[model samples]
Target chain A: MALDKRFIGREYGPFVYTIGAEKLREFTLAIGGAVPGAGTPGEPLPHVSPLLHDAQAAKAGPYGDVIAFPSFAVVFAIRPFSAALSDPEMGIDIQRVVHGEQELEFLDVMRPGDVMTSTGRIADIYEKARMGFVVVTTESRNQHGKVVVTGTWTGVVRG
Target chain B: MPRTFQTGDTFTHVRECDRYRPIYYAGASGDFNPIHIDPEAAKAVGLGGNILQGLCTLGWAVEAVGVFVGDPGRVRRVRVRFSKPVRPEDTITFQGKVTAIQDGRLTAEISATNQRGEDVLKGAVVEASLE
Candidate 1:
C-alpha cells in the first residue's frame, strides 16, 4: 500500500513514556558499550552513566537521580510514532517500509524516571522518483512543556 | 579560557555488526519489525540479508559523536540518510570530520560504510558547547 498523503501535517497524539536507567544499560551492554563512571571534567567516561550527570537541577524525569544513556532519548517519543503509523487510514505497508533516515536533536538532558509526553505529527509527505517519502517528527517534553528532545524519522515507501 | 577550534580536525571509527546485533537492538527498542530481525523475512522480499535497523545504526553513529563531544547534551543536530542497508555479516565504518565551525557551533559530515565499502548512511551533524 502506498503511504497516505492525506495524513500529512496531521498530529496523531500525545504519547507518554516513562524511561528508566536500567534499560539504558541494557541497550549499551547489548551494543558492546562499557558502563561509564562519571562526567567530571577531564575524567575519562564510560558508555553508561553510574548516576545522572545533570542531577543537581530541578528536573522532571526521575527526580534527576537515575542517569540516561546518550542515545536514550530516541524512545521518548516512540509511542506517539506507534500510534501514528498504525492508523488504519494511513496506507503504510509494514513490509515494504524501510527507514530511510533519522535526525535527533537534544535540547536538554533528560534523566531516568522523568515523566514526559511525546507529541507526534506527520511533518512531510512527498513522492520522489518511484518511491514515496514520509517524514514524521515527534517532540518530547516535560510536564512543564520543556522540550527535552526532537526526533524526526524519514521512511521510504516502495511499492 | 576555551580552547581554539578548527574545522580541519576530524575523527573516524570503523565497526561492524554481528549476526545477532540487529535483533538485539530491535528487541530493546520495541520495534519488532521482522525485516531487521528475521533473515528469512528479509529474503522473502528483495533484501540480500537481514538489514540493520536505521535507528540502531543511527545509535551507533550517535555513540561515536557522543564520545567525541564528551557530553550527551553537546549534540545539537544530527541528520542521517540511509543509502543502503547494513547486513549482519558486514563490517561497517563511521567516517566523520568537522566540516564547519561558526559562533560556537560545529558541523560534521559523517558516513557509515559496510565491509564492501557500501555507504550505509550519509549524514551530517551540528554540535554546540554545553558550557
Candidate 2:
C-alpha cells in the first residue's frame, strides 16, 4: 500500500457532494436492515438531532442552505482516499481490507441548509499489533472556508 | 428521566423492526464481519447467535428520518452513538421524534431498541428543506 508513515501530512482534495436521504434508506434496506418506513420521501422524519447550544455558533457553521451531518465530513475525503490507494505506485489490495474505525471532530456546530466543502489530509499512521493504522483527518468548511466539522477515518490494513 | 413522544412523531421501532437479514447485506455493503456472517464466530464472541454490526444498525436510523426530511436531499446530517449490540434473532424498531424546526431545517432524535427494550444505538439527525 502507498499509504503509510510517508503519506502523513499529505493533504488531499476538497471533493464535495450532497448527502441524500433515500440513498441512506436504500443502504439500510440493501443490508437487510430497515427502520420500518423511515428515510422515505414525504414520510415522517426519523428522530435524529444535534443540540446546538448556541444559535449564532450553529448559524456560522452553515453553508448556504444545506445543513451537513456529523458523519457528512467523510464524504469529502472518499475521493482523496481513492486517489491515493488507486495511485499506480501504490498497490493496495482493497479486497482484503476492513473498516477499522471512524471518528469525527467538529470545530464548530453544523446545521441544516449548509452546503459544505470537505478538504482533508493523511494525518497519522501507526503499526499496531498485527494491524496497520491509516488515519485520514478531514476538515469540512463552508464556501468561506470556515471550519464546520473535522472527521477521521481509519482503515485497519491486515496484510 | 422520562421522555415521551406524541402521535405523528417518528421514532425507531426497534421493537417492531425485525427480520434482519445481514448476510445478504454483508455481500452488498462489502462488510463481511464474521460476527455478522458466521454463526459459529458469533457464538465464540458470546453472542450465542449471529449478531449484526453497529453500522448496519445505523443505516436504519438514517432511513427512518429520511422520509420526514422529504427526500434524501433534505436530510442534512446524521450522527449516531452505539450504546448496545444487536443479535440476529432480536427484532429492532427505530423510534424518532421531531425536536426542533429552524427555518427549513428539521431536527429529530432517534434510537434503535431491541424487543427486550434495550437501546442498541442512539443518535440525532437533522434535515434541510428544498423550499
Candidate 3:
C-alpha cells in the first residue's frame, strides 16, 4: 500500500517535557562518556569526554550548567511522531520503518529544568520503488517561547 | 578560549558503540525500535543483527564538532544522511575539515566510517560560529 500523500503537512501534538539534569548525565554516560580513553585514539576529542568524571567542570562549562547534548533534542522531539505515524488514517507500516537521515539545528542552548513544548509535522511523504518515505520535522520551544532546537527525521518504510 | 580555524584544518574523533549501547540510547531517547535493542528481531527483519540508532551516531558526530569548536552550544547546524547500519562493537571515526570560514562562521564537511571503513554516515555538514 502506498502512503497517502494527503498526510503530508499533517500535524501532531504539542507535547511538553521538562529537561532534567540527571537525564542529561545518564545520556552522557550511556554513550561511554563516563570513561576516559574510550574513544578512538588521537585527533578529534569527544566533547563530553572532559566532564565524564568531573561534575564541577560541566557546571562551569559554556552553557553554564548541566546542558543537554546537542542531539539530546530527540528525547523530547520524537514523541509526537509516534502519534502522528500511528494515526489510523495514515496507515504507515511501522514494522518496516527505518531511520534514513537526521538533521538538527540548535538555535538556543537547552538547559536542564527548562520546560520544552514540541510540535511535530509531516514535512513530506513520497513513494519510490515501492518504498514509502516520510519526513517528520519537530520544533521544540523553551518555556519562554524561544525556539531551542529543530529536528528533522526521515523514515523509510519498506513496502 | 576560542581558537581561530582556517580552511583546510582537519580533526578526527572516534567513538565506540558497545553491545548494550542501543539499549541505553533507546532508554535515553525513548526510541525503542526493536532493531536497536533486539538482535533476533533485527535478524528477523533481514538486518542480520541489531543496529545502533542513527541519531545516536549523529550525536557522536555533533559531539566531535562541538569538541572542535570548544563550545557545545556553538554548533548551530548539523545534518547527515545515514548510508550504512552501525553495528554493535563498531568504532566510528569522524574525520572533518574546515571547508570555509566566512562572516564569523566556520563550515566543515564531516564523514563517519565504521571499523571496516564503510561509510555509515555521509554528506555530513556542520556550521558553527567562530569562538
DockQ of each candidate relative to the true complex: 0.45, 0.11, 0.56
TM-score of candidate 1 to 2 decimals: 0.84
> Comparing candidate 1 with candidate 2, which one achieves the higher TM-score?
1
Top candidate by DockQ: 3
TM-score of each: 0.84, 0.50, 0.91
- Model 1, A24: alpha-carbon shift in Å? 1.8
In terms of lDDT, the best-performing candidate is 3
| Cα RMSD, each candidate | 5.4, 10.0, 4.0
lDDT tens digits by residue: candidate 2, A28-125? 34533333333332222333322112234334533422333333344443456545544555455553334455444445434444467776777787
| Second chain TM-score, each model | 0.88, 0.76, 0.96
Off by over 4 Å in 3: A32-55
lDDT of 3 at B93: 96
TM-score of chain B of 2: 0.76
TM-score rank order: 3, 1, 2
lDDT of 3 by residue, B81-125 (tens): 999999999999999999999998889999999999999998999
